[model samples]
Target: MNGRRTIGFLLLIGLVLWGCSGVHPTSNAVWIAQPEFSEVDNRLYSARIAPQKGESPYFSFFLLTLTNKSSVDLVVDWNASQYLFNGKPQGVMVFEGIDPEAVKNAMVPLDTVAPGASFSLEIMPMRLIAWSPIKEKTAAARSISPGMLPIGENGILLALRHGNGHITIPLSVRISREGLP
Candidate 1:
Protein backbone atom coordinates (compact mmCIF):
# COMPACT_ATOMS: atom_id res chain seq x y z
CA MET A 1 0.00 0.00 0.00
CA ASN A 2 2.79 2.38 0.88
CA GLY A 3 4.54 1.58 -2.38
CA ARG A 4 1.34 2.14 -4.27
CA ARG A 5 0.82 5.48 -2.61
CA THR A 6 4.34 6.53 -3.42
CA ILE A 7 3.87 5.54 -7.02
CA GLY A 8 0.62 7.48 -7.13
CA PHE A 9 2.27 10.54 -5.69
CA LEU A 10 5.11 10.30 -8.17
CA LEU A 11 2.63 9.96 -10.98
CA LEU A 12 0.82 13.06 -9.82
CA ILE A 13 4.03 15.02 -9.72
CA GLY A 14 4.82 13.76 -13.20
CA LEU A 15 1.47 14.93 -14.42
CA VAL A 16 1.97 18.39 -12.99
CA LEU A 17 5.46 18.55 -14.39
CA TRP A 18 4.08 17.48 -17.72
CA GLY A 19 1.40 20.15 -17.56
CA CYS A 20 4.14 22.67 -18.23
CA SER A 21 4.09 21.47 -21.81
CA GLY A 22 0.62 22.91 -22.20
CA VAL A 23 2.31 26.22 -21.56
CA HIS A 24 2.21 27.90 -24.93
CA PRO A 25 5.60 28.53 -26.50
CA THR A 26 4.45 32.06 -27.19
CA SER A 27 3.39 32.27 -23.57
CA ASN A 28 6.06 34.23 -21.88
CA ALA A 29 8.18 31.98 -19.65
CA VAL A 30 7.37 34.43 -16.89
CA TRP A 31 6.87 32.74 -13.55
CA ILE A 32 3.52 32.90 -11.88
CA ALA A 33 3.56 31.86 -8.24
CA GLN A 34 0.34 32.00 -6.23
CA PRO A 35 0.59 30.98 -2.60
CA GLU A 36 -2.41 29.20 -1.06
CA PHE A 37 -2.20 29.51 2.68
CA SER A 38 -2.40 26.39 4.82
CA GLU A 39 -5.41 27.30 6.89
CA VAL A 40 -4.87 26.80 10.62
CA ASP A 41 -7.58 29.40 11.29
CA ASN A 42 -5.93 30.98 14.33
CA ARG A 43 -5.47 34.61 13.40
CA LEU A 44 -3.60 33.51 10.32
CA TYR A 45 -0.93 35.37 8.42
CA SER A 46 -0.79 35.69 4.63
CA ALA A 47 1.76 36.09 1.83
CA ARG A 48 1.66 36.48 -1.96
CA ILE A 49 3.75 36.90 -5.12
CA ALA A 50 3.25 40.14 -6.94
CA PRO A 51 4.18 39.84 -10.64
CA GLN A 52 5.89 42.90 -11.98
CA LYS A 53 5.30 44.18 -15.49
CA GLY A 54 8.62 43.94 -17.30
CA GLU A 55 10.61 42.21 -20.03
CA SER A 56 10.65 38.51 -20.88
CA PRO A 57 13.07 35.78 -19.64
CA TYR A 58 13.81 38.01 -16.66
CA PHE A 59 13.79 36.89 -13.07
CA SER A 60 11.44 38.61 -10.67
CA PHE A 61 11.81 37.65 -7.04
CA PHE A 62 9.13 36.31 -4.74
CA LEU A 63 7.58 39.38 -3.12
CA LEU A 64 5.69 38.31 -0.04
CA THR A 65 3.65 40.44 2.36
CA LEU A 66 2.99 38.66 5.63
CA THR A 67 -0.04 39.87 7.56
CA ASN A 68 -0.57 39.12 11.23
CA LYS A 69 -4.29 38.67 11.84
CA SER A 70 -4.26 37.45 15.41
CA SER A 71 -3.91 39.44 18.57
CA VAL A 72 -1.10 37.35 20.01
CA ASP A 73 2.40 37.30 18.60
CA LEU A 74 3.23 34.61 16.02
CA VAL A 75 6.80 33.48 15.73
CA VAL A 76 7.69 32.19 12.26
CA ASP A 77 11.12 30.60 12.20
CA TRP A 78 12.82 31.73 9.05
CA ASN A 79 14.05 28.67 7.11
CA ALA A 80 11.78 27.53 4.33
CA SER A 81 11.40 27.83 0.57
CA GLN A 82 7.72 28.67 -0.08
CA TYR A 83 7.72 28.11 -3.85
CA LEU A 84 4.97 26.25 -5.69
CA PHE A 85 3.68 25.72 -9.24
CA ASN A 86 0.24 27.26 -9.53
CA GLY A 87 -1.66 26.35 -6.33
CA LYS A 88 -0.16 22.94 -5.73
CA PRO A 89 2.74 23.00 -3.27
CA GLN A 90 5.88 21.34 -4.65
CA GLY A 91 6.97 20.21 -1.21
CA VAL A 92 9.24 22.03 1.23
CA MET A 93 13.02 22.04 0.85
CA VAL A 94 14.71 21.30 4.15
CA PHE A 95 18.15 22.86 4.44
CA GLU A 96 20.84 21.95 7.00
CA GLY A 97 18.94 24.09 9.52
CA ILE A 98 18.89 27.82 9.88
CA ASP A 99 22.24 29.55 9.81
CA PRO A 100 22.47 33.08 11.19
CA GLU A 101 24.75 34.10 8.36
CA ALA A 102 22.35 32.72 5.75
CA VAL A 103 19.43 34.46 7.36
CA LYS A 104 21.41 37.66 7.64
CA ASN A 105 22.34 37.51 3.99
CA ALA A 106 19.25 35.92 2.37
CA MET A 107 16.41 36.71 4.76
CA VAL A 108 15.21 39.64 6.82
CA PRO A 109 14.28 39.14 10.45
CA LEU A 110 10.69 39.75 11.40
CA ASP A 111 11.90 40.56 14.92
CA THR A 112 8.58 39.70 16.49
CA VAL A 113 6.34 41.22 13.89
CA ALA A 114 3.39 42.13 16.12
CA PRO A 115 -0.24 41.20 15.54
CA GLY A 116 -1.86 43.15 12.72
CA ALA A 117 1.65 43.91 11.57
CA SER A 118 2.72 43.38 7.98
CA PHE A 119 6.22 42.66 6.71
CA SER A 120 7.54 41.79 3.30
CA LEU A 121 10.19 39.27 2.12
CA GLU A 122 11.68 40.06 -1.23
CA ILE A 123 13.80 37.33 -2.91
CA MET A 124 15.81 38.81 -5.77
CA PRO A 125 16.53 37.17 -9.13
CA MET A 126 20.10 36.08 -8.40
CA ARG A 127 18.77 34.42 -5.26
CA LEU A 128 16.03 32.57 -7.12
CA ILE A 129 16.28 28.96 -8.42
CA ALA A 130 18.39 28.21 -11.46
CA TRP A 131 18.26 24.94 -13.45
CA SER A 132 20.74 22.90 -15.45
CA PRO A 133 20.95 19.32 -16.63
CA ILE A 134 21.22 16.87 -13.76
CA LYS A 135 24.47 14.98 -13.24
CA GLU A 136 24.40 11.16 -13.41
CA LYS A 137 24.68 10.53 -9.65
CA THR A 138 22.27 13.33 -8.78
CA ALA A 139 19.87 12.08 -11.41
CA ALA A 140 19.99 8.64 -9.86
CA ALA A 141 19.20 10.11 -6.47
CA ARG A 142 16.34 12.09 -7.97
CA SER A 143 14.93 8.87 -9.40
CA ILE A 144 14.80 7.46 -5.86
CA SER A 145 13.92 10.20 -3.40
CA PRO A 146 14.09 13.58 -5.01
CA GLY A 147 13.29 15.01 -1.62
CA MET A 148 16.31 13.39 0.01
CA LEU A 149 18.87 14.62 -2.50
CA PRO A 150 20.58 17.92 -1.70
CA ILE A 151 20.20 19.43 -5.15
CA GLY A 152 18.57 18.76 -8.54
CA GLU A 153 16.74 20.45 -11.39
CA ASN A 154 13.90 20.67 -8.87
CA GLY A 155 16.02 23.11 -6.85
CA ILE A 156 16.81 23.33 -3.12
CA LEU A 157 14.92 22.44 0.05
CA LEU A 158 15.28 23.92 3.52
CA ALA A 159 14.66 22.28 6.87
CA LEU A 160 12.75 24.32 9.44
CA ARG A 161 12.54 23.75 13.17
CA HIS A 162 8.95 22.84 13.94
CA GLY A 163 8.80 22.12 17.62
CA ASN A 164 10.72 18.81 17.83
CA GLY A 165 10.12 17.78 14.25
CA HIS A 166 11.00 19.64 11.05
CA ILE A 167 9.26 21.02 7.97
CA THR A 168 10.76 21.42 4.51
CA ILE A 169 10.46 24.17 1.93
CA PRO A 170 11.85 24.30 -1.60
CA LEU A 171 13.99 27.42 -1.64
CA SER A 172 14.51 27.39 -5.39
CA VAL A 173 13.06 25.20 -8.15
CA ARG A 174 13.47 24.63 -11.86
CA ILE A 175 10.52 22.79 -13.44
CA SER A 176 11.12 21.77 -17.03
CA ARG A 177 10.34 19.29 -19.77
CA GLU A 178 11.56 15.75 -19.31
CA GLY A 179 14.03 15.97 -22.17
CA LEU A 180 14.01 19.60 -23.30
CA PRO A 181 14.85 22.72 -21.41
Candidate 2:
Protein backbone atom coordinates (compact mmCIF):
# COMPACT_ATOMS: atom_id res chain seq x y z
CA MET A 1 0.00 0.00 0.00
CA ASN A 2 2.75 2.43 0.92
CA GLY A 3 4.66 1.63 -2.25
CA ARG A 4 1.55 2.19 -4.34
CA ARG A 5 0.84 5.49 -2.60
CA THR A 6 4.38 6.76 -3.19
CA ILE A 7 4.29 5.76 -6.82
CA GLY A 8 0.97 7.52 -7.20
CA PHE A 9 2.37 10.63 -5.57
CA LEU A 10 5.41 10.72 -7.85
CA LEU A 11 3.24 10.17 -10.90
CA LEU A 12 0.98 13.00 -9.85
CA ILE A 13 3.87 15.38 -9.19
CA GLY A 14 5.08 15.61 -12.77
CA LEU A 15 6.70 19.01 -12.39
CA VAL A 16 10.23 19.25 -13.70
CA LEU A 17 12.50 21.17 -11.35
CA TRP A 18 14.09 23.12 -14.18
CA GLY A 19 15.89 26.06 -12.57
CA CYS A 20 14.36 26.29 -9.13
CA SER A 21 16.59 28.14 -6.64
CA GLY A 22 18.18 25.10 -5.03
CA VAL A 23 18.05 22.35 -7.61
CA HIS A 24 20.57 21.46 -10.31
CA PRO A 25 19.02 20.06 -13.48
CA THR A 26 21.31 17.06 -14.05
CA SER A 27 21.43 15.26 -10.71
CA ASN A 28 19.45 13.29 -8.17
CA ALA A 29 17.62 15.79 -5.91
CA VAL A 30 15.90 15.67 -2.59
CA TRP A 31 13.93 18.38 -0.76
CA ILE A 32 14.37 18.76 2.98
CA ALA A 33 12.31 20.85 5.42
CA GLN A 34 11.32 21.10 9.13
CA PRO A 35 8.22 23.17 9.92
CA GLU A 36 7.20 24.24 13.40
CA PHE A 37 5.88 27.26 15.35
CA SER A 38 8.01 27.28 18.48
CA GLU A 39 10.50 29.84 17.23
CA VAL A 40 7.86 32.50 16.80
CA ASP A 41 7.94 34.66 19.89
CA ASN A 42 5.34 37.38 19.80
CA ARG A 43 3.03 39.12 22.25
CA LEU A 44 0.02 39.46 19.97
CA TYR A 45 -0.29 35.93 18.67
CA SER A 46 1.15 32.43 18.43
CA ALA A 47 1.03 29.88 15.64
CA ARG A 48 1.72 26.29 14.66
CA ILE A 49 2.40 24.96 11.15
CA ALA A 50 2.52 21.40 9.87
CA PRO A 51 1.99 19.25 6.79
CA GLN A 52 -1.52 18.05 6.02
CA LYS A 53 -2.60 14.51 6.84
CA GLY A 54 -1.94 11.93 4.09
CA GLU A 55 0.10 14.49 2.15
CA SER A 56 3.60 14.08 0.81
CA PRO A 57 6.55 15.11 2.95
CA TYR A 58 8.05 16.63 -0.16
CA PHE A 59 7.13 20.13 1.00
CA SER A 60 3.66 20.71 -0.35
CA PHE A 61 0.73 22.29 1.49
CA PHE A 62 0.21 22.28 5.25
CA LEU A 63 -1.98 23.32 8.15
CA LEU A 64 -1.71 26.67 9.86
CA THR A 65 -3.07 27.07 13.38
CA LEU A 66 -3.00 30.63 14.66
CA THR A 67 -4.00 31.81 18.10
CA ASN A 68 -4.91 35.33 19.12
CA LYS A 69 -3.39 36.31 22.46
CA SER A 70 -4.08 40.01 22.45
CA SER A 71 -7.00 41.77 24.00
CA VAL A 72 -8.37 42.85 20.65
CA ASP A 73 -9.55 40.95 17.61
CA LEU A 74 -6.68 39.99 15.32
CA VAL A 75 -7.03 40.06 11.59
CA VAL A 76 -5.02 37.77 9.30
CA ASP A 77 -4.40 40.16 6.46
CA TRP A 78 -4.00 37.79 3.57
CA ASN A 79 -3.27 40.71 1.33
CA ALA A 80 -0.36 41.61 3.56
CA SER A 81 0.78 38.16 4.59
CA GLN A 82 3.55 36.66 2.52
CA TYR A 83 5.36 33.45 1.72
CA LEU A 84 9.08 33.51 2.32
CA PHE A 85 11.70 31.43 0.55
CA ASN A 86 15.37 31.57 1.49
CA GLY A 87 14.46 34.61 3.61
CA LYS A 88 12.76 36.48 0.80
CA PRO A 89 9.18 37.11 -0.25
CA GLN A 90 7.96 34.55 -2.79
CA GLY A 91 4.35 35.73 -2.90
CA VAL A 92 1.07 35.84 -1.04
CA MET A 93 -0.24 32.64 0.54
CA VAL A 94 -3.51 30.97 -0.50
CA PHE A 95 -5.86 28.39 0.93
CA GLU A 96 -8.08 25.70 -0.51
CA GLY A 97 -11.34 26.97 -2.13
CA ILE A 98 -9.71 30.29 -2.98
CA ASP A 99 -10.29 31.28 -6.57
CA PRO A 100 -7.19 30.62 -8.64
CA GLU A 101 -7.97 33.74 -10.65
CA ALA A 102 -7.90 35.76 -7.45
CA VAL A 103 -4.54 34.28 -6.59
CA LYS A 104 -3.28 35.09 -10.06
CA ASN A 105 -4.53 38.66 -9.83
CA ALA A 106 -3.51 39.10 -6.17
CA MET A 107 -7.08 39.27 -4.90
CA VAL A 108 -6.73 37.81 -1.43
CA PRO A 109 -8.96 37.45 1.63
CA LEU A 110 -8.60 38.23 5.33
CA ASP A 111 -9.66 36.37 8.44
CA THR A 112 -10.41 37.68 11.93
CA VAL A 113 -9.57 35.91 15.16
CA ALA A 114 -11.22 37.03 18.36
CA PRO A 115 -9.07 37.40 21.43
CA GLY A 116 -8.07 34.00 22.78
CA ALA A 117 -9.51 32.30 19.74
CA SER A 118 -7.80 30.16 17.13
CA PHE A 119 -7.88 30.11 13.36
CA SER A 120 -6.86 26.93 11.60
CA LEU A 121 -6.64 26.01 7.92
CA GLU A 122 -4.55 24.37 5.24
CA ILE A 123 -2.50 26.70 3.05
CA MET A 124 0.36 27.02 0.58
CA PRO A 125 2.07 29.75 -1.38
CA MET A 126 -0.02 30.97 -4.28
CA ARG A 127 3.09 31.25 -6.36
CA LEU A 128 3.66 27.57 -5.68
CA ILE A 129 0.07 26.60 -6.42
CA ALA A 130 -1.55 29.02 -8.85
CA TRP A 131 -1.05 30.33 -12.34
CA SER A 132 0.91 33.57 -12.46
CA PRO A 133 2.46 35.92 -14.97
CA ILE A 134 5.87 34.61 -13.98
CA LYS A 135 4.84 31.07 -13.16
CA GLU A 136 2.76 28.38 -14.81
CA LYS A 137 -0.09 26.69 -12.95
CA THR A 138 1.10 24.00 -10.52
CA ALA A 139 -0.57 22.05 -7.74
CA ALA A 140 0.59 21.47 -4.17
CA ALA A 141 4.32 20.78 -3.92
CA ARG A 142 4.77 20.37 -7.63
CA SER A 143 6.78 23.57 -7.84
CA ILE A 144 8.80 22.80 -4.70
CA SER A 145 11.25 20.49 -6.34
CA PRO A 146 14.33 19.17 -4.59
CA GLY A 147 17.46 21.20 -5.40
CA MET A 148 15.27 24.04 -6.69
CA LEU A 149 14.81 25.49 -3.23
CA PRO A 150 18.24 25.94 -1.72
CA ILE A 151 18.84 24.40 1.68
CA GLY A 152 18.22 27.39 3.87
CA GLU A 153 15.53 29.34 5.71
CA ASN A 154 12.04 29.17 4.19
CA GLY A 155 8.59 29.86 5.63
CA ILE A 156 5.79 32.43 5.98
CA LEU A 157 5.59 35.87 7.46
CA LEU A 158 2.04 36.23 8.71
CA ALA A 159 0.55 39.72 8.90
CA LEU A 160 -1.75 40.23 11.83
CA ARG A 161 -3.78 43.34 12.56
CA HIS A 162 -5.17 44.33 15.92
CA GLY A 163 -7.12 47.48 16.72
CA ASN A 164 -4.97 50.16 15.12
CA GLY A 165 -1.70 48.24 15.06
CA HIS A 166 -0.30 45.05 13.62
CA ILE A 167 2.29 42.37 14.29
CA THR A 168 4.12 39.98 12.03
CA ILE A 169 4.34 36.31 12.88
CA PRO A 170 7.07 34.23 11.30
CA LEU A 171 6.68 30.47 10.97
CA SER A 172 9.99 29.04 9.90
CA VAL A 173 10.20 25.69 8.09
CA ARG A 174 12.84 23.08 7.25
CA ILE A 175 12.03 19.75 5.58
CA SER A 176 13.92 16.57 4.79
CA ARG A 177 13.71 13.69 2.31
CA GLU A 178 15.11 10.34 3.42
CA GLY A 179 14.36 6.64 3.08
CA LEU A 180 12.94 7.13 -0.38
CA PRO A 181 13.94 4.64 -3.06
Candidate 3:
Protein backbone atom coordinates (compact mmCIF):
# COMPACT_ATOMS: atom_id res chain seq x y z
CA MET A 1 0.00 0.00 0.00
CA ASN A 2 2.81 2.44 0.91
CA GLY A 3 4.66 1.72 -2.38
CA ARG A 4 1.55 2.64 -4.38
CA ARG A 5 1.07 5.77 -2.33
CA THR A 6 4.65 6.93 -2.99
CA ILE A 7 4.27 6.52 -6.76
CA GLY A 8 1.04 8.51 -6.74
CA PHE A 9 2.63 11.29 -4.71
CA LEU A 10 5.57 11.59 -7.11
CA LEU A 11 3.24 11.84 -10.09
CA LEU A 12 1.26 14.59 -8.42
CA ILE A 13 4.40 16.58 -7.70
CA GLY A 14 5.58 16.27 -11.28
CA LEU A 15 2.29 17.64 -12.60
CA VAL A 16 2.45 20.68 -10.37
CA LEU A 17 6.04 21.55 -11.35
CA TRP A 18 5.23 21.24 -15.07
CA GLY A 19 2.30 23.58 -14.72
CA CYS A 20 4.37 26.27 -12.99
CA SER A 21 6.80 26.93 -15.87
CA GLY A 22 4.13 29.51 -16.69
CA VAL A 23 4.60 29.41 -20.44
CA HIS A 24 1.58 30.78 -22.20
CA PRO A 25 -0.69 28.22 -23.74
CA THR A 26 -1.14 30.43 -26.82
CA SER A 27 0.20 33.52 -28.65
CA ASN A 28 -1.66 35.86 -26.37
CA ALA A 29 -0.55 38.53 -23.88
CA VAL A 30 1.22 35.89 -21.80
CA TRP A 31 3.23 34.63 -24.77
CA ILE A 32 4.95 36.35 -27.70
CA ALA A 33 5.10 34.53 -31.02
CA GLN A 34 8.45 34.38 -32.78
CA PRO A 35 8.53 35.56 -36.39
CA GLU A 36 9.34 32.82 -38.90
CA PHE A 37 11.22 32.97 -42.20
CA SER A 38 8.07 32.65 -44.28
CA GLU A 39 6.45 35.33 -42.17
CA VAL A 40 6.14 38.14 -44.67
CA ASP A 41 7.01 41.79 -44.70
CA ASN A 42 8.74 43.17 -47.79
CA ARG A 43 11.79 44.20 -45.83
CA LEU A 44 14.62 41.62 -45.83
CA TYR A 45 15.74 41.44 -42.20
CA SER A 46 19.07 39.77 -42.85
CA ALA A 47 20.43 40.12 -46.37
CA ARG A 48 23.82 39.72 -48.00
CA ILE A 49 23.31 41.94 -51.01
CA ALA A 50 24.35 45.51 -50.41
CA PRO A 51 21.27 47.68 -50.15
CA GLN A 52 20.76 50.35 -52.76
CA LYS A 53 19.36 53.74 -51.72
CA GLY A 54 15.79 52.72 -52.46
CA GLU A 55 16.01 49.05 -51.54
CA SER A 56 13.90 47.91 -48.63
CA PRO A 57 16.27 46.58 -46.00
CA TYR A 58 15.54 45.40 -42.49
CA PHE A 59 17.24 46.02 -39.14
CA SER A 60 16.56 45.22 -35.53
CA PHE A 61 13.72 47.35 -34.29
CA PHE A 62 12.97 46.92 -30.60
CA LEU A 63 9.41 45.92 -29.77
CA LEU A 64 8.52 45.70 -26.11
CA THR A 65 5.35 44.27 -24.67
CA LEU A 66 5.29 44.32 -20.91
CA THR A 67 2.78 42.44 -18.76
CA ASN A 68 3.09 42.61 -15.00
CA LYS A 69 1.57 39.13 -14.61
CA SER A 70 1.96 39.61 -10.86
CA SER A 71 -0.38 41.72 -8.77
CA VAL A 72 2.31 44.37 -8.24
CA ASP A 73 3.64 46.78 -10.87
CA LEU A 74 6.81 45.37 -12.44
CA VAL A 75 9.65 47.66 -13.42
CA VAL A 76 12.27 45.68 -15.25
CA ASP A 77 15.18 45.94 -17.68
CA TRP A 78 14.99 44.29 -21.09
CA ASN A 79 17.67 42.71 -23.30
CA ALA A 80 17.75 40.46 -26.36
CA SER A 81 20.05 38.11 -28.24
CA GLN A 82 20.05 35.67 -31.17
CA TYR A 83 21.25 32.08 -31.16
CA LEU A 84 20.94 28.82 -33.04
CA PHE A 85 19.12 25.68 -31.94
CA ASN A 86 22.34 23.93 -30.90
CA GLY A 87 23.02 26.60 -28.24
CA LYS A 88 25.52 28.45 -30.38
CA PRO A 89 25.21 32.22 -30.04
CA GLN A 90 24.73 34.08 -33.31
CA GLY A 91 24.52 37.60 -31.90
CA VAL A 92 23.40 39.67 -28.93
CA MET A 93 21.59 43.01 -28.77
CA VAL A 94 21.61 44.93 -25.51
CA PHE A 95 20.31 48.32 -24.33
CA GLU A 96 22.47 48.78 -21.26
CA GLY A 97 24.15 52.21 -21.04
CA ILE A 98 22.97 53.09 -24.53
CA ASP A 99 22.37 56.77 -25.21
CA PRO A 100 18.94 58.00 -24.19
CA GLU A 101 18.32 59.69 -27.54
CA ALA A 102 19.12 56.50 -29.44
CA VAL A 103 17.01 54.32 -27.15
CA LYS A 104 14.16 56.82 -27.32
CA ASN A 105 14.26 56.53 -31.08
CA ALA A 106 14.46 52.72 -31.08
CA MET A 107 12.17 51.86 -28.16
CA VAL A 108 8.90 52.95 -26.60
CA PRO A 109 9.35 52.79 -22.84
CA LEU A 110 6.51 52.84 -20.35
CA ASP A 111 6.79 54.14 -16.82
CA THR A 112 4.29 51.52 -15.74
CA VAL A 113 2.74 48.90 -18.00
CA ALA A 114 0.22 48.13 -15.22
CA PRO A 115 -0.64 44.80 -13.66
CA GLY A 116 -2.25 42.24 -15.99
CA ALA A 117 -2.00 44.83 -18.82
CA SER A 118 0.52 44.98 -21.67
CA PHE A 119 2.24 47.66 -23.74
CA SER A 120 3.71 47.16 -27.20
CA LEU A 121 6.08 49.00 -29.54
CA GLU A 122 5.96 48.43 -33.26
CA ILE A 123 9.19 50.09 -34.32
CA MET A 124 9.80 51.47 -37.78
CA PRO A 125 12.06 49.33 -39.94
CA MET A 126 15.74 50.25 -39.93
CA ARG A 127 18.25 49.76 -42.74
CA LEU A 128 21.63 48.02 -42.49
CA ILE A 129 23.43 51.15 -43.62
CA ALA A 130 22.49 52.89 -40.39
CA TRP A 131 24.50 50.52 -38.18
CA SER A 132 27.81 51.80 -36.86
CA PRO A 133 31.09 50.71 -38.46
CA ILE A 134 31.84 48.72 -35.31
CA LYS A 135 28.72 46.68 -35.84
CA GLU A 136 29.82 45.94 -39.40
CA LYS A 137 33.25 44.92 -38.17
CA THR A 138 31.76 42.56 -35.60
CA ALA A 139 29.61 40.93 -38.23
CA ALA A 140 32.69 40.27 -40.32
CA ALA A 141 34.43 38.75 -37.29
CA ARG A 142 31.75 36.08 -36.91
CA SER A 143 32.64 33.07 -39.06
CA ILE A 144 29.14 33.15 -40.54
CA SER A 145 29.77 36.74 -41.68
CA PRO A 146 26.43 38.51 -41.59
CA GLY A 147 24.76 37.94 -44.94
CA MET A 148 21.21 37.05 -45.80
CA LEU A 149 20.50 34.24 -48.23
CA PRO A 150 18.11 34.77 -51.09
CA ILE A 151 16.10 31.88 -49.66
CA GLY A 152 17.82 30.60 -46.54
CA GLU A 153 16.67 32.05 -43.24
CA ASN A 154 17.62 31.22 -39.66
CA GLY A 155 15.78 31.21 -36.33
CA ILE A 156 17.01 33.44 -33.52
CA LEU A 157 16.41 33.45 -29.78
CA LEU A 158 15.53 36.67 -27.96
CA ALA A 159 16.16 37.12 -24.22
CA LEU A 160 14.33 39.70 -22.16
CA ARG A 161 16.17 40.42 -18.90
CA HIS A 162 14.34 41.57 -15.83
CA GLY A 163 14.84 41.16 -12.08
CA ASN A 164 17.96 38.96 -12.26
CA GLY A 165 16.24 36.51 -14.62
CA HIS A 166 14.76 36.59 -18.12
CA ILE A 167 12.04 35.50 -20.45
CA THR A 168 13.13 34.27 -23.87
CA ILE A 169 11.34 34.73 -27.15
CA PRO A 170 12.13 32.97 -30.41
CA LEU A 171 12.29 34.52 -33.90
CA SER A 172 13.11 33.48 -37.45
CA VAL A 173 14.38 35.32 -40.51
CA ARG A 174 14.33 34.68 -44.26
CA ILE A 175 15.28 36.67 -47.36
CA SER A 176 13.12 36.57 -50.44
CA ARG A 177 14.54 35.84 -53.86
CA GLU A 178 12.31 38.61 -55.12
CA GLY A 179 14.23 41.88 -54.86
CA LEU A 180 12.78 44.65 -52.75
CA PRO A 181 12.60 48.36 -53.50
Q: Best by TM-score, which number?
A: 2
Tens-digit lDDT track of model 3 for 9-61: 99999999989877533312221222422121122111111111121233223
Per-residue alpha-carbon lDDT of candidate 2 for residues 3-86, written as tens digits (9 for 90 to 100): 999988876665443334564332343555564432454787777776532333355665788888889898888878887877
- Runs in model 2 lying further than 4 Å from the true structure: 1-32, 35-42, 130-152, 179-181
Reference-based lDDT, residue 179, model 1: 25
lDDT at 144 for candidate 2? Answer: 28
Local distance difference test, each candidate = 0.40, 0.66, 0.37
Superposed Cα RMSD, model 1: 16.1
Preferred candidate (lDDT higher): 1 or 3: 1
lDDT of 3 at 11: 96
Rank ordering of all candidates by TM-score, starting from the highest: 2, 1, 3
Q: Give candidate 3's error at residue 2 in angstroms.
A: 99
The C-alpha TM-scores of every prediction are 0.35, 0.64, 0.33
lDDT by residue for model 1 over 29-107, one digit each (tens)? Answer: 4343222112122335543334322333333333444566756564545444444443334543222222335544656
**Under the 3 Å rule for N, CA and C atoms, how many clashes does model 2 have?**
11
What RMSD does each model have against the real structure?
A: 16.1, 11.4, 21.2
